[model samples]
Structures are given as structure tokens and as C-alpha cells.
Target chain A: MNPNPPLPPDQPRFLRLFLASEREVRRTVLAMVPSLADAEDIVQQTAAALWEKFAEYDEARPFTPWACRFAQHHTRRWLERRAIWQRLLEHGLAEELTQRREALRPEMERRLAALEKCVEKLPEEQRRLVTGYYYDRTGIGALAEAQGRSVEAVYKMMQRIRQALLECVRAATAQEVEA
Target chain B: MCAGCDRAGGGGVNFPSPEFDGAVAAVCDGSVLERQAEELNALLRTDAAARDEYLWRVELHARLACDADAILGRDATAVSEPAPVAQISWRRAALALAACLAVLLGGVWLWPRAASQEDIVELVRATGSVSWSSEDGRVRPALEAGARLSEGSLTVEGAASSAVVKFRDGSELTLSGDAELSFSDHGKKRLTLRRGAFSADVCPQPTGHPMVIRTPAAEAEVLGTKFSISAVAEQSTLSVETGRVRLRRLADGATVEVASAQSAVATLDATVKMEASSRGVAAARWREDFRTKPSELWQGSWLPAEGAEPARMATVPHVAATRKDGTKVITQAVSRKDSSAGRIVSLMPDSVLTMKFRMQRSKPVTVLLSRHESSGAFAGNYELVVPPSTGQTDASGWRTVSVPVSSFIAKMRGYQQPPSGGQVSLVYIVCYDAKAGMEIAGVAIESAHAGTSTNP
Candidate 1:
């Protein structure tokens, strides 16, 4: 037997398109569910649903919107089953957000690309702070404790970093347009 | 004080309110209080700008959260602890007094304690003939999976052997067979890949200290990425799977930026050869939304070879007036007589070209992949032909085409096959036999394979 069997041609094509839109689906799910673990779970479920119903999908249209709809469906079902958060968006609001996301997808992608450049341009200390807070999932209180700083000070620093990042992204985006 | 709130109080400033930031941060971290939650909801309901900012922050946060490892050059599981600043060796008297004070004060004391080695990274997993040598030159012949490794050198001795070293900051380095690497965290995260091949899945390094992987002929300044570096005698090759790597040839101090799906080879006394690489899978695929002007994304020059008219191409607001959706497409019209009238783009290796196009006239479309050889001659030219039936001409709807890199390699022309490991510098979509008017949208070069390791 072949150690690495080739995937069915149709399967690779469908998977390529699916993977291309995977980030958008995950981002949508994350916006609904703040918890990374929960969002990941929903994304996994969405992927399964997408694969199961991929044959039914019309190839004429873009893949993102379709994938996002499946993601939203899974997200809503996950939220309902867990009753995780009371402040979760209603179906109508969720649908509205999805449509808005679809319209702004291109711009959002541009911003994301700009963000990578912006992040590289950030000051070393600020980058570490971001890595700790966001990537490491270290709580603000824990970070404060580790740094021997007040929670408010850390929060203020985080706000400053976010502000700086936003400005940098905007500046980078402008430069990209200019170039 | 909330800066946005203060600015808002002053008069007209479009800054996000401090309350908004705090609420967003709290919500993102899953630590929102009831009052803060209520305020956040109310703000989202009332303020459209706030909603937009919320979405932006959410997207940014998600992106960062997902890419923290590549950005930080640390392992996801490595929860970094505060480094102990001072160490003091004391006698029994100090220890007794500290214990008594701790008991009296309910386990809280302000006394200076001895510094501990809590921040040291360990060899969490090792397999198949892996050994380590300590800073003191203590040689350990074989290490178990959970062996503790401080600042030291590790060697993977045999074929089919590998070892994984986990750093305190959550970064991981996987050394392939016959590889030797020394790591030190004296100041910044540093690793010297002395010989053989190794893949690093780095977490975001601290701002001042980028992870530097030094080989004999070159050094790669890693700013958080999943990359593989192989060093053998005279040459060192760096292949970037995700993020960016700045490779500097040690012989002449020449540097080049290698982005995702790109690679560079550094050799002694030679200009480093920057090539496209398709190794260890693609972490993120490429997609071109025609939202931006064509010139911004692709080479704008249209090459009209013999018997071909100048191809008319423009970024139109919509492909057709029939579809009212606010989207854009690159519309190209080429004469039937033209053999080489199309756009050219620099593409990475192992890319599958996918495009949605609506052709006005049914004709066979040829997509050509080309590259220049070391001798400054155009060596590799590969073509994939889409039959007229497949390259649909119906204006009512667009047809999609997916062409894999394997197909291009299999169909390459000339004595020399296209280099399987480097970048393809030029791509041409030509309609030679018919007057082709095509509206192209969703042109993308997706990765052939998903990355091997999952993001932690």
C-alpha cells in the first residue's frame, strides 16, 4: 500500500477552498465566543459541517460567505447548548454581523496584513507585553503580579499598546495605498 | 483617566472611549464584571464607531491569539515566570527567622529569598539517540523524554532520530537526525545550529531579543516564525514556513528577507540565493481579493508578443452591471492573434493557482510558469492548458479553475525541469487561438498542504 495516498482531486480542491476561508470562519466564531477554546471547538464543528455539506455548496459563489454561515450556525448552536454567555448576540444581530463581515472582508484582510507589519515595527517591550497578555493568555492580574505592578497600570499600558497598534495599522495601510 | 473620554469631553475627537477599551479587554480576556458587561452592551448598541472598533479589536485579538507562537518565538505551553533578580546564600539563622515571620504573617513576608532557577527551559521530549552536553561539559549519553535541559547543546546522532527542546517561553525546537544545536538564554533567546537540519516553532520573542539561529555560513534573525534551517559544510539553507526571517550570509554580511513560503541558501563567498520554498507545508495561504487596484497587487505591464495585440486589463468596480454586489474584478481582453499577452507575477513554490473567470469567447487558455536559471537564462517553462469547455465563456456566471503545482511540474517543457524547491518568478495566462475577454476574480495561490504542527 502507498504510504501517502493522494486525496481525491475534488477533495483537495474543496479542501483548498475551505482552508482558504478557514481563518474567516474562526474569526467569526471568535467574535461571538471570546473564549479561544470554545471558539476553536465551534470552528471544528463548523469544519465538520462544511465538509459534510460541501457537495451541496454552489461553487459559483465565493466560499467565505458560505463557510461563515456554517460557522455562525455552529456558533449559535454551541452558545445555545452551553448557555455560556447571556450577552451573546441574537440570531438577527448575528446575521447582521455576518453580512457586515462579508461586506468588509477584503478591508479586514488588508488590515490583518498591515497588522503583521505593524507588529514587527512595535517596540520590544510592547511586543513582549502583547505576547504575554494575548498569546500566553496570561491574565492582567497575573501579569501585574509577575511584574510587581498595579492592575490599573498594566491595563493602562495595554490600552496604550492597543492605541499604538491601531495607529500603526492605519499608518501602514495608508503607506500601502501610497506605494 | 480614559484618554478617549477626556478627548471626547474636550470637543471633537474620534478616539475610542476608555470605558470601551477596558470593556473590550475585559471581554476578550473573559473577565468582564456585570456592570462593565452592561456598559459594553449599551455602548455596542448605541455607538456605531464603537461597534466597528469592537469588530476590529476582536479581529486583531483573534489574529494575535492565533499567531502568538510565531510572533513571540516561544512555546504556547511555556508560561513564563518572573526571573528572580537577586540570590543570597544564608545560614540557618536567616532561614529560621524567615519561617517564623512567614508563620506570624500568615505566609506573607517581605524578606529577600534565595534566587531560584525557575525560568530554565527543559528537554521535555526526546526520541531516538538524543544526547546533551551541559555548560560544564558534562556529557549525558542518552536522555529520557522528560529530562531537564538547561543552557546546553543537544545532538541527535543517527538517521531517523529527532529531539524536541521546549523553552521556558513556550518556544520549541525540533532537531532532525544527525543535527547538533546549542541554545542559550543568557540575555536573548539564541540557538546555534552547528550542523544538520532543525525546525523551530518559535513563540513570540521579547521585543529587544529576537531569536537568532546561527549556522556556519549564515545567521537567521527570527522574529517569531515556524522555519527550518539546515547546515551542511559550506552551505546553510533557511526555509520559512510562516512569518518572516532575515537571513544574513556570514561571509559577506549580505542580508535578505525571506517571507512565508520563501527560502534562502547561504554559501561561503557567494551571494545568498533567495528561492521559493515549499517545505513543511504552508501555515497561511495567499488570496488576492481584487478590491485593491491591479497595479498594487500584480505587475501592471502587459507583454504582447508577436502577432498579439496589447491586452486591455483594468480593475473594474464590478465584472458586470448585472450583479449589484459591491465587488471588483480584473477584466482582461486579448486579441486571438496574440500568443503571449497576459500578466506576470512572482509566485512561491508548491502553490495551486485558483481563479474564477468568465470568458467572452470560448478558447483554450494556457497558464505558463517560468523561472530563471543560475546562468541568467530562462530555463524552466511549464504550461497547463485549460480546454475551451473547461474555460467556460458564459457571461451569465463565472467558472472556477484549480491548477496544482504538481500539474505544472509534470507538464514542464525544455531539457531542464523547473526547480522543485525555489520560487517561480513569472506566470502568464495566455489565450493564443481566440479573442478572449475574461473577467477574473478570486485569483489565489493556495498552499498544497496545511502546516504539520497545530498552533498551541
Candidate 2:
């Protein structure tokens, strides 16, 4: 074996780490911006900002938390520029939430894994509703009109489904901890 | 008992208050109101339990938003059920011959026999400026509602204009303004939607004659269903309201079967991707008729808030009735001294609040619904000031109003205090307006359902 193995290029390695942490970065941005469309815009901005400053990233440090800092910065700027009605979190509150999220990252990962299993256990109709609302990005008004139900009824169904998912996740995570 | 005692003494140590759970649940679904938001924010800032629940909900909401496809088991390479191939191919051949004969006969010979073929469609409703062009490329103003067009292009211009076409086979197509589409009966029953949005309620076609709607980027083949197709320059989206649709991307010939309440998208350079239909829930019907006295059904007393008027029950004949029930009504006469308000306790969380009432005078009338805990403490609520032009009253002047339980949840979320539990103990309906007489006959809370009512 060679005593001095060549190290990976900084740019390519940084890109790998950046891409690997994309889910966490997106979650960080979404925590600040409740709207998925706005969060996606902020995520794009964060990616660009992180790429520009990739030289400053220390390889010894963890990449996900570093990437999340850039995401939080962009999220704050987006919140400042957004309309009052659209602003979900204040700057100070957003900062605190980010810190709390960072501390709970491992636990969140566990819960998310549990959530996947729980989501599969949902009733077919409820699963479709969740997928349509979150994945398909169908507007609530349009969905209500299509389903011939009131927007309120659709929202209620979603709430119940979410409640079930939360309970399922809690139970699953608890079982994992015990195991 | 004091509020603090109610919180600490009601439950054992380490157990979370029911109110906290309700508040957090509302937050996860984004249904909290502003006032409640402030309270929950303060609690989240100081209370550890509140913060923990808030964090959990926030993470749950974020994960669902960002990774829904993964969670919902949507994989690009996943195969759908195979479509019936032999039947489709044979039907196409039969329809192609009929289309060829219809084209050869010209407009005059086929106009009278169009009804028998089940291929002709008529413009039954036109709003604003709609125009159409025949096979010769001559543009003509779509003047009336009953214009029959066999095989040509129809265009609806202007932002406010729209046209509804009823096919001879009992299907309906509603085209929004700035939309252009060409229909042909020659081959398979096909309509080329060039641009803009249109919703189609297609009747089942004779096998082999699937209705094919083509956009710039994709083709949607339907046997029978209600669906909407929207096309822009870069992308085309198909949302199926009911039944099923097969969408094929022109670029790669990749196909996906979109079921009822599912959607699919095709881009100019990308394969079609199937997704959950962005549409809302199925139709729901929940009604409560107060044929029995309100006091017998509801546990809580109707107590007016500070400076609010008390509600009284009176007998009225022939005021508008949504259900064909009796004539006893709940009447509230608003004055400068009081706002009319009443509260009912122990309601199912999934229940919807529906009321039948008529405004004696056309003044600004406001309706507020507030949710409370079992101990009569505030939780969250929604407030709506009735608009002047609702205009849904029948000839006798009675109108029905239905409010979904989720509306209150949404309002609570707006306030930053989402409810967590599956049960609500108190509901308060408040009316704000001086000297506005409001007559309410039926007030009931009923569970929600899916699917539309034929009578509604």
C-alpha cells in the first residue's frame, strides 16, 4: 500500500457531501418556510450559496450541519423578503427552531424511518389523500371541488390522517428504542 | 379550580394536557389562528413539553412535505397494472372507418345523422367571447349556446370567457378562457387541446374508441371519467377526478395509468410521472336537523359572552327550510348592547356545523365558531363575516350554511394553536351586528362523508 494515498479533489468531495445532505437541508429550509414552493426556492438559493463558499467548508467538520447553516441563512433572507401573511416564523424564532432541530437530528431520522412504515399502514384512501396533498401538490380548493367535498372536510380528513401517522411513528420509534 | 390547577391537578405527572395535544395537532396541519398562535408561541418558548410537541409536529410536517413520494411508495420504475390491449386495437380500427365515412360525406349529409353516431358535440353554454373555426380555417363568432359543431376548432378568448360543450353521448367538456381545441371524429374519438385548461366528464366510450385528448407534450386516453387537462408551453398536467386515465408521454412513449384522484405530468423532454391527484377529498354530506329541542341534544347552556345578546327560540312559518322539517326556529335580534352567541358542549371532532338561517335585513352579518375545552376554557375558533352577495337563498328566503370542522382547525392554526385530539367539548356560534335580525331554524352537528349529494 502506498504511504501517501492521493486525497479526493475538494470540489468533487464537497459536491458529494452537499448532495448527500440534501434531505436535511430541505428539511431545515421547510422548517422555516411552511410553503413547499417557497422552501424549494430557498433550497435552490442555499445550494448556490453553499457551492460558492465550498472552499471555506472544513472537511474535518460534519457536512450536514454546515449545509444546514447555509440553508437557514437563505431561509431567513427569504422570510424577510416575503409578505407578512406568508411569513411563518420570525428571525429569532427561526434561529431557535434551527438549533432545536439540529439537536434532534438523530431522533428525527429515527422518526422519519418509522414514519415511512407508518405511512404504508394508512388506509388506501387516506394514503391517496396524503400523497395527493403533499406529493402531487394539488390545491385544496381544486381537490375539494374534484372530490365533491368542502375544503373543510378535506382538511379534517388530512388532520386525522396526520394524527394517525404521528401516533404510529411514536409507537414505532418507542419500540425501536426498547429493542 | 384555577387554570393552573386545571392543568396540573387534572392529570398525573408526566402526562400532557389534552389542550396541548390539540394545539400541536392544529400546528402540524397549519390550521391555527393568530390569537391562538400567540398563546402557543409563548407556551412553546417557555414550556418544555410544548416545545417538544411543536418540534415533533414541525419535523413530521417537513418530512411529509419533502419526502411524500418516498413515503407514499412512488417509484418511477414501478409497474402499473397492464392495460387491455387487444380490445383497444380492434376498437380503433372500427372507429377509424366510421370517421373516414363521416369526413367523406361532408357537413350537410352528416349534420342530420350526427345524433345517431354519438360523435357529434354541441356548444350548450358559452360565456363571454367564444369563437370557432371550421375545416376551411374561417373564424366565426360563437354567438349562441346551442351551436352544433361536428369537427372543427373551438376557441374561448378573454380572461372571463368560457364555453361548455355537451357531447351527444352525454359527456361534458368545460373549456376555460384562452383555450383552443380541435375535435376530429375521423379516427379514434380525439380532441387536440392546443393550450389552456379544460375539464372533461367523459361517458364510457364503445370499446376500441377510447377518447384521446392530446396536448403538446402528452396524450391522455380515457375510457370514461371526469378529469381535467391543463397545458402550457413547457408542461402538460392531467388530473383524474374519477375513473382512470392512461397518459403517454410523446417524447419517450412512456405511459402511466392515473387512477381516480391521481394526477400525472409530462414535460416536453421528460417521461410522464404519476402522482397523487392534487384534488381534495371526495364529496361529503353531513347534516343535522333540530327537530328535537336543542337543549336535549346539547349538554352546555347557551350563555352570552360579555356585552353579547342572548339567543331565543321562536316559532316561524314558511321561512326558508333546507330540510323539510318543522317551523320552530332559533331567532337572534342583534342590538348595540349585545352580540348574539351560544355554545354547545361535547361535539365530535369530525363533525361539521350546519345552520339554516335568513337575514331580515341585508346588513353586514358576521358568524363566528369557537372551540373550547371541556372545562369551558378557550381553545381555538374561526370567524366569518357574511358577504353581502351569497345569493343562495330559495324563493321563500331561507338559506343553508355548512362549515367544516377543519375550518376551525385552520383558523386555530392561523392563530398558531392547532388542536391535537379527536374530540371537541364546546362550540360557540357568535353573530356580530346591531339591529340585524337573523332567523335560524335548523342547527345541527353531523359527521362528514365522502361523495357528492345529487340533491345538494
Candidate 3:
């Protein structure tokens, strides 16, 4: 078995502790809460309360399991207050999946920033096409007419643009992880 | 029916319309297979494998779209509302189209449109200076040197390198040095600071008439009274000398009011912090001191000759007249015995003071100067007596007597000392009972002066 390593005690590092075990703790809290919204609220509250109680925690042990136990405690307390929200807690998969989604937020935001930069560097005409479709709610058919091209041709262009952007975001995120 | 699909199958779905395709692209995140299925459903109809592949492609697309939205939205929202920018671009396009159409349709006449008052006002600056000239000879406002303004269309040239502009309400705005200013607005009251530092003591016009100062960074609105605003490329500061000013971030629409003697700063996406400015309430004594410098009944043209020697003309033939209503309304043309003999004593009050000119007799007549109660003394106790002409042919004009209350009461005996510091309390002219039918023709009392004298 891997020996429990000690966290640095010299400086306040509760933030690091919270970040490291957020996923498991969030999942456990979500399982006991009804609705993704309620689960998210409960997990946030539990994290804050747990951080305040960090002085009571043993630093040498695994952080994730310990935080999960605290999260479960708070989730049970939250469920006790409202009967209707407790009913949503019966659907175990929904709550569990939502926690996974919440855990992926940091990764998603990072990827999103990367994809945005690549899209902006596109040629003005292409940028317009993308903006017209995404922001203006303009259809490819209207874009086709404006460009004096067939609808099918516009569709093909959009498909290529989408593929290019996806590739760009993926590459950027991969580079970030490596760095 | 939750059909789990992938990216490859998206191409096969025969979408009802292209708008549906764009909507799919906007809402769906490409990494989510569930969203990918939704996108493929909008685009095509296909087998489960194809649908799954298509879902993958859409998931990728959705992710890409999110990225694009974030990057662009961040940069764009950091600027002003996109609607106007978009409209500006659209206007440029429309102008180009109009130009082309004008050429095709021959002989199109475009009327000359005069720029708006907002355009004219925008030339005013919070700081710095500018010079303006107008061949039309209309007095216009200028900007201070090195000050900046916003985009505006109206341009007015200064009469000189620098000159003072007197607003309609007799307030002065000084624009020093060579300054150029332009003001523009879209039929709304908006100001664009074009150039130079120009200071104006603008009387608060009606509401909705906003005084806006535009700098490179943001716009400052003078909601009320006095303020001085200055702007550079990266920062804009509005300091209120008096009253209040609201500094608005034109880009982000954030606003903060700078109260009396306080300054607010606007830069980039940062919050504004108001600081106390060392420059306190600007010198406004000039405005208060500048009374419409009183002129003669005739404009201000009449003046005493430089070296004229004064000679005494005492008791020159005098006359007084009773009005049709038995009120002694005296005029120089009516029943005047002498015009030059009346000792013209000027009464001017330095501050607020009330005084009464009395002509005592057993009975009194209405004292009228210029056919009106120059003072309302007649309606009260004293009988404003109109003295009849003893001999002369002209209207009953009496020799004007100079009697300051201090000197006149000193000669007579009991009068109370004026209360606050030596502020003169009252002025009384006693026509020693010999002039029974005597009329107090003209009496003038205003902001008081130092010494007493008679007009010979």
C-alpha cells in the first residue's frame, strides 16, 4: 500500500486540498441531493464548510475519501430539510453524472478559450459565415444566397470550418496538459 | 426516444432547414454524444451507426462553437454594445450602395444637412485648449490646448486664436490657445469631446439635455452644476468642482457619480474609485460679480466727459405735476420746470439693503418715475408728492436734492444706526415744508456705493 504522504503545513493550502478531491466529494454529495442544481449548491456549501474545518483533518491520509465523507454528511443534512429534493436523490445515475459534468468544468473552460482564438484567426469572410450562423441565427441557405453559392456548398464549408475549430481546440488543450 | 449517435452520422440527416443546422451548431457541445445526436437529428436521417458517428462530429462542432463564442464574445463585449458597431458597419455598406445607386439613377440631389446642437456642444472639452473660427460671425465655443474630444460632425471655427464665448444666459466659457472642437449626435443630446480644454459654467438646462464629454477612454456626463473633466488615451477622470457629475464607461456601461470636489477614474474593465481632488470649487466669483454692468436709460453709451469741471446750479427753476389719477407721476417731458437742475444722486447698494425716499407734507401724492413706482413707497405710508411748477414753461421738474440718510438724519436728529456692520438702512429726502405741492419725481436705489455726490 502507498504510504499516506503529508501535505505542506507551513502555508495555508486548503484551496489545493479542496481542488484535489473535488470530483469524489462532489459525486457523493450529488448522490444524496435531488436535481443537478441542488447537488451543485450542496457540494459548494460542503466544500466551503469542509475547508473551514480543515484544521481537524489528518494530513497524512488520502484527501479524496475524507472529503467525500464530509460531503456525504452535508448532503444528508441538506436532504433532511426538504422531502421533495430527496425524491430526486432516488435517481442515482442523474446525480452521479451531473457531478462528473461539474468536475469537467475547468477542463471545458480551458478548451473553450483555445477554440475561440482559432475561430477568430479565420479569414474575414469565413468569420462572418461563422458569426452569421452562430450569433445572428442566420441559416446556411441565407448565407449561401448572400455568397452567391448553392446551399450544399455553404453546408460543406461550414462542416469543414467546424472540423477545423474542433481540431484546433483539441490540439491546444493537449498542449496545455503537456505544459 | 433518446437515440445515441456519433459524429460520422450527422452528414446523413436530411435537415428540414438551414436555420435548424445553425441552431444545432450554436447549442450543442461537440464532445457530448447526446448533443451530437440532437445535431444529427436536425441535419439528417440515418442508421444507428451513422447517427452515432454524426453525433461525434456534432459534439466536436459544438465544442468548437463554444470556443469561438467565448473568444469573440469576450473581446467584443469588452467594447461598447455590438448593436451600434454593427449598425455603423451596416450604415457604411448602405452608404456605398446608395453611392452606386445614385450614379446609376443620374442627377440625384442630396440636401445639405446642418449638424445638430449635440454636435456643436461636443466640441467643448473638460481640459486642454483649442481655437475655432467661423466666417459666419457666429460666436462659437472652443477647446483647450492638448484636450481630446469624441467623434462628432459639426465644426465651428474660432473668431480668434483664443476668445471667450458668452452663452445666452450671460455666462462665460474661456477657450485658450489653439483649439479645435466638433460636436455630433444622432438627434439625441449626446456630446463628443473633439479637442482642447474648454471650461463652461453651464446653467443646468432642462433635463434630458445631457452635457457629455468624450475622451479616448470613456464618456463623462455632467448631470448637474460645475465639473472639470480630463481624459488621455488610456484614462479618463472627471472631477466635480461643484454639483455632481456621473462618469460612465461607454464600453461597459458602468457609471459612478463624482460628488462635490471628488474625482472618478475610468480605465479598461476596472472598477472606478473616486478620490478627493486638490482643485476645489473653481473660482466662480467672476460670474457672481459680473452683474449686467448697469447701463443708463440709454444703453451704456453715455459717459461723463473726462476732465469736465463741476459747477453748482442750486434751486434751478423746478416744477412738479400731478398725474390724471391725482398720483404724482413725474416725467422729464411732463410738467418739467428744469431737466438739468435736478441733482442726480446715484444710489447703489453693495449688498442687499432696503431704503425709502420720503417727501413729507400734510398730504402726499403718488411718486411715479418712468410712469411706474421706481420704488413702491407711494403705495405705503409716505405721500409721494408731485410739486407744481412755480414759473418755468417746461414740465414741473424739481432740482434733484442729494440726501444720504446718515448725513440727512445727522442734520435732523434721531435715526437708528444700521444693524449689520455699517450697512445703510434707509435714505430719506425731506423737502422742508416750503414745497407743499412738491412731488418726489424720480428716486433710484440700487447696490450702494461709497460716497455721495450731486449731478450738476
Q: What share of the true interface contacts does each candidate keep?
A: 0.21, 0.23, 0.06
Q: Summarize candidate 3's per-residue lDDT along A19-97 as a digit string, tens digits.
A: 5565456445533332233454566556555655677889899878888777777776765653223332333423443
Candidate 1 lDDT, A49-111, residue by residue in tens: 675576789989999999888887877776564321444354344555556666776887887
Task: Kindly report which residue stretches of model 3 are placed more than 4 angstroms away from their true locations once superposed.
Answer: A1-179, B1-173, B177-180, B185-188, B269-456
Candidate 1 chain A TM is 0.65
Each candidate's DockQ: 0.09, 0.09, 0.03
Candidate 1: tens digits of C-alpha lDDT, residues B1-456? 111222212222233766567667655655443345445555566567777777777777777765554544342223344322221112112333343334334435323211111123445444346776766555666554435555678887532345666664446676644578988775577888888777676766667889888999888887677777778787787767778889988888888888876667788967445444443322324454344343432432332322422223322221111111322222332111100111122334566777665556777666655443221122344667888667443444667888765576523112244344333434445554334665455555556453221211
Candidate 2 segments whose C-alpha is farther than 4 A from its true place: A1-15, A55-62, A82-92, A176-179, B1-33, B74-456
Better of 1 and 3 by DockQ: 1
Candidate 1 ranges with C-alpha deviation above 4 Å = A1-18, A51-63, A81-84, A88-92, A133-156, A174-179, B1-16, B66-456
Compute the lDDT of residue B237 as modeled in candidate 2. 74
After aligning candidate 1 to the native by TM-score, how far in Å is the CA of B125 from where it should be? 30
- The estimated TM-scores of all candidates read 0.34, 0.37, 0.22
lDDT of 2 at B409: 40
lDDT of 2 at A71: 83
Among incorrect, acceptable, medium and high, the docking class of model 2 is: incorrect
Ranking by DockQ: 2, 1, 3
State the iRMSD of every prediction, in order shown: 17.8, 15.7, 22.6
